[model samples]
Target: MAKNKNGSGFSRRKFLKGVGVGTGALSAGLLSPAETLSHAGGALAFGTPQGPGAVPITLHINGQAHRLSVEPRVTLLDALRMDLEITGAKRVCDRGTCGACSMLLDGKVIYGCSMLAIDAQGHEITTVEGLSHNGRPHPLMTAFVAHDGQQCGFCTPGFIVASKAFLDRTPHPTREQVNHGLGGNLCRCGTYHGIREAVLDVGNPTGKAKTGGQAHGAL
Candidate 1:
């Protein structure tokens, strides 16, 4: 046989043979496409984004510590409602535009839907459910009920939570101040009058001592 110009004497037949062997090795070692995809999505494994996997963290809420494993992408609202079973914060807009998912973070009101659970670590989260104690409603809660601030009640939780933060800062807010402070929360029922009255009642001297009395009776 005549020698090829290249020192290795490579030929089409030899190249084809090498490809066949390499393909055979790959076929023997690799999984099917469906099987590979299934494995990739199976669990907390390699090649997965660390941010999407469940991570252990503590949430300080309502004067208590909650230990849980949650994905970093899980919103504070979802973590509270789904994982912790604290559904007081309603998922209304779920987009921060509506304050239905509002909660107190370190005493500052924030939209729970817009915040990541991982970012809330080490901060005190106060939800609507946390506002009550010993079977007694918070002053704001009492005022809401007394003033009939809620109709459908879907937005009541967020309103009440936001009111707490608002009242904490401006304890005796005027009608205008109350309007501006709680502007974030929206009520479809057009109960602005009642909501404003509810919050104002908490600070009014005439209504302070009578807290929960009229509200409970009315309820």
Candidate 2:
């Protein structure tokens, strides 16, 4: 509250009006939160309420940097699949309950749908598509195919990414450990048995990879 020429402070009604104006500006995209406010007549100054529209953001994913334009509300999953065309992270149960949208942020498992694209700026993002080597499939991916870990494919990508992160932490996991490690993801197809087996086989240095050729389809 500022004193006017008469040395009077702002009334409650005037303070509320200023707050409303600031809030409206944010939602309507007229001014970003980072934008500085200007003073006019010792009162809250509001710009023309035009939507902020899409803003440019850069994301580092899969050993590459991508520049794109998106609204602040866009989730990392939407930005990956819809904007950048990097669809390895599947979107299911977008509320972060199901791990279907799992991806790696700095080698740690995360739900892409639960994080904003604007907030994923600095992390090293790795989707399922990024798991493979130069020309060969990632060992975990190969293990999934060998064990028939995926069916219907909606949850495969998440499982693969999560499994990768889990194994990175627990390289030699028991069957029970593998089960607990993948507790966050779900497979409606009830392929938990094969999924756990895949993780176990990948963790086992002496276990032979199965002669399975079924491909993990696109996310």
Candidate 3:
């Protein structure tokens, strides 16, 4: 028989008993938060507690550091759209599934809706709005427009951002490769074909060169 080995986890019997005790105490108003913390023992770490209120946090976004006071539960998408007024990332699914709220964190693609605003501090966040140089569009952006890669435009920003990450990883990709690379982002308008084409156009210079480098802007 195996014993509870540090953070490995609790045995089924121990877990059920603990849950039963805690739930009953919580329901009967007998378990105080301080008491609960006190019972947790020193080594069974729960990490540093945050808050049930707003906290000051700095988010480095698009070469700028935006300081704001937001609740610990506030998502990065909410911070960008609500607090910071940088609303390039759409709030469609609000979950990580649809990828409408995708943004580039530290030059890598991530779903903004799933990440806490507080956790994004000290990291470079690039939104769709940042993908322009002196108001000039990135080549991938141009190619997207030229290929009619967007229709509803809700998923376009996420697709473009994800495409930028994809191109960075696979700068010279085939049509099938682009299709596979950008599988994370989805479009309700069924514009996958055009989106793939745009990525290919940006990758292939044999066709008219759209703009600049793969790393240009957010692309």
lDDT of 1: 0.76
Name the lDDT value of residue 77 in candidate 3. Answer: 95
Question: 1-219, model 3: which lDDT tens digit per residue?
Answer: 124667575665446546664232221123345543443323322387766666556677999866566678889998787666677898998879888898999999999999998788768999988988899998889988999999988899999899999988988676666767888788999998788779878877665333432323223
Instruction: Report the C-alpha lDDT of model 1 over 152-183, residue by residue, as the tens digit.
Output: 99999999999999888887666667778999
Tens-place lDDT digits, model 2, residues 1-219: 233556576555346646663232222123343332221112222354322576556678999877666677889998887666677788889999789999999999999999988778778999998988897899988888988998898999999999999988987676656767899999999999899878877876565322233322111
lDDT of each: 0.76, 0.75, 0.76
Better of 2 and 3 by TM-score: 3
User: Which residues of candidate 3, in runs, are more than 4 Å off?
Assistant: 1-48, 208-219
Stretches of candidate 1 off by over 4 Å are 1-49, 207-219
| Angstrom error at residue 208, model 3 | 11
User: Clash pairs of candidate 1?
Assistant: none
Q: How many backbone clashes does candidate 3 have?
A: 0
